[model samples]
Target: MTTPLPEQAKSIIKCCRNGQLAQLKELLSEGIDFQLFDSPLFAPLNTALKHGRWQIVRYLFKENNLPLNKKTPPIIAAAQYSKDNTTGLEIVFAHTGNTEAVDTQDRTALMTAALLGHEKKLTYLIKNATNVNATDHSGMSAFLDAVVNQSLKNCDTLLKNGADPHQITAQGDNAMTLLLQNSTPNPRLIKKLLQQQLDLNHKNNHGHTSLSISQSKHPKIYKVLQAHIEAEKQMELPIFAPSNPIEVAIQPEKNTIKQRPLNEEKTPTKSYSETADDRSSNQLQDTQSKQLSVELSSWFQAATSGNLGLLNKLKIQGLTVDEVDSKGCTALIHAAGSGNRAVASFLIQNQADIEHRSHNGSTALSSAIISNSKSVVDLLIKKQANPAAIGPGKYPYITLAAAQWNAGIVSILADAGAPVNTLDPSQLNLYHNVMLAAEYYSNIIKAKDTVRVIHHLGLDINQTDKEGNTPLHILCGAHKEKAYNADDSQIANLTHELLKLGALSNLTNKKGFTALQYAKKHHLLNTKGVIYSFMS
Candidate 1:
């Protein structure tokens, strides 16, 4: 009885998956079928690329010469898988010219690489597979992805790989058009992309061409592109020339209007008056230099004026509202801490982002809490401030705010569903601080307001501090063995008040002793009696 052969295409795909080059070769020698999975096309290659099996990919491509699908290659899968195991990306592309697949999101493997600034993967794909002229479904191309992701190295690689600069987004928006649309455009990147060609009249889906778009969003980049576009137009000959010599002769005056020169040269030839003007200009420049420009860069500024008019002007000028200041605070951060409702309201109205953190990881809402301003805290929450924003001190920003004692602020933060009992990474609870505050204030009245507020809010009355002394333990030891004045009675009354409010009697102090042990150690017979009676 003869053994029937396995299906040839399945066998080849299996060999590719298993890296069985020798068996694959033997089967190929026997005239086995290659297109068994050809209905979807490149399924074997796709699987091999996904797993990043380089040897198998090399075998399928170099040895078997499998057809490489230019439109729907498996490069995206390869890039995604390569995040964990990066060895296969180079091998597959070197072996197969199949990196051209633009995925459903209009994102290609090259675009992904460029977007993340994956220089090696981008270099390999640009060199081996992807066509530079292709734009994704969203009108974004790999070049635009590079700009958005701030991958200058990827841009250089694409440009070196013969990527055409004239490729535009679906809306006819080219890289230059996008550069000008950004509030702050990178001039160097724009110049590099425009080296190939500039499509002046090419309008995107919005009916606005590169020139018009540049003119509106970013004037700095616009000036550069406008000059370049006009120069190109000037160098080209007129398309429609008058046919007759008589007609041409008659049109001289109309054609000679003073069109502005594309590139005007500045020559510095100084006369006496000019020298005086230059000195005056120098003084003005020096004066301007002495005056700190309120327009801080997107990341760092100073909080000098409490006025938010500067913030308003900044937003109008397209500065990031969440720009961190010198102290790592944003406009909203200063506004919150300053308790200036007007400034905070202005920033909120102008779309100031509420969820940004300062250098210390504190948000505007957190700053408001430290300032103890209930109004600021309320405004921030209404603007959807993130309760989880940790401050530079590494706890909830609200934990550091000033008006933290304000009942309304407490309710507002508590109602926002903020984690009330969040412990630090070191397992330190918020109750630890409460215990420490008890130690700072010997007078019951001094600590009564906050304690009462926290207690009423249902904070754990039995929670122990690092020294293992709970609130009850601290209250028992507030006065030592010496006899007290009438104020001593108030301390005793406060203790009874707290106990009635659910303070636990059995919690121990640092020495593993209960409140009774602490009272007995200090020889306070009256206090010991009260604590022991409570324990009983």
Candidate 2:
């Protein structure tokens, strides 16, 4: 039977796991050993690292000088445990300078990060000489991990960092075979591997080559592979071959050779026929192009004008509803943006792609939010549109709704599992959205409601952008001399709300300016006073 832990040990372990840094510090200062182990599992440093208690982990490392370069280092712990807390991983990397450290599973920090689709950590590791193609005990390479996880972005990153596409897994499946075997094969990824000139003829353990495996399951991929193989075969063949039996019969042994005229009579006839065929093909192509243009224009007009009958007729006439205009706006996108509920409904019912993004990355749901169409937004969400999808300018649908102050749309999206704390690719958070809303709308009521929604969702009020500026800093730095009239009371209320919601006052931007400093620099006495009161 396993022995039970003492109350003091349990308390210390609890503090580390729950991120109770102050409590942990108090316990450590008293009699609790900083190096106390929880038997066969973890030490205090490991416990803190495992739970992603970065503050506690840092304190133990800096104050106690706890070594991080163990058999299982804190870097691996941070890679495995730190989900959204990338700062902890960065700190561990900065302190240890060991990106290639492996854990008990023989998995390096880079492999762990790639397996979990941690792009930031993976990038850092790649930059620090960590091998991109390192495999774990299971013979799963970081590239294979990214492929199996279906993380296309990570796959691209690994490929760009020189991960071998031809590297086979333990099961004898290379990247191409594994990717093609996926239920929903990423065409882009497959094309990328194809461009790398992976061995299509290489068979797996199942004796299935890329062509043979994809022939039955993935016809599109099979066709692409087939065409490539045929082209390669053609390239391998000699350009000048015997055209007739007479030439073949008169081959190597004969000394005399008969030469044809440079300008044969049949050449002009063949050239004339080829030109006639080209003219016919061009005429047919022109006619088809004109017809397709007219059809697309009519389809777009029907969608934009909310003519359901005309849309139905066009669909009956074989017009693809999901086809985009020059701007990449599909019929559904047009209907959603125009607030034409009936037309949008018809398009959805007719199987229009709900998640189709425009050229600017705007989805149908985002367009509805932009048009302030609550019903259209609800319909799109009901049809299973991704509420967390980023649209034009890298703004999420929820952020766009917040910018419009459409509380109803925000609630709908939130209920549909839209993340309140959704960050952009550049790490812009809800705080950034609040600033964008204030700048774009300039409506005090809308600004207040945006803050209210953010608070209600319990998102990180203290979250900073890449520049390290919090929402408070952004609000304080707003130029009052801009186009809209500055509402002092509204600004004060927003600042007060941020402080009340635990927005840190001492946090500085990259330029070494706090919220109060920004306010003072802008000469906004009201904003400065509010911030000062909070600090005091």
TM-score for all models, in order of appearance: 0.39, 0.45
- Alpha-carbon lDDT of model 1: 0.57
Model 1 C-alpha lDDT per residue in residues 1-536, reported as the tens digit of each score: 42343577668667766767688778667773543334443366666766666776766666655655444556675775545344666665565556776666757887777777677777777655436757777767787888776666777666544455566666667776666676766777776555445676677778887677777776666687777654333222111111211110000010011211233357678788788877887778655432222245211222223445555665676665555544456667766655677777877887877876654455677666655557887888887887655654455543332112334565577678766666533233444333323322244553455556666667787776555666566555522334322233444555665666677777656677776665555554665666556767
Per-candidate total of colliding backbone pairs: 14, 0
Lowest lDDT 10-mer window, candidate 2?
246-255
- Candidate 2 at 163: error in angstroms? 51
Q: What are the Cα lDDT values of the candidates? A: 0.57, 0.69
Regions of candidate 1 where Cα sits further than 4 Å from its true position: 1-289, 294-320, 401-404, 440-459, 465-467, 474-496, 516-536
lDDT of 2 at 310: 76
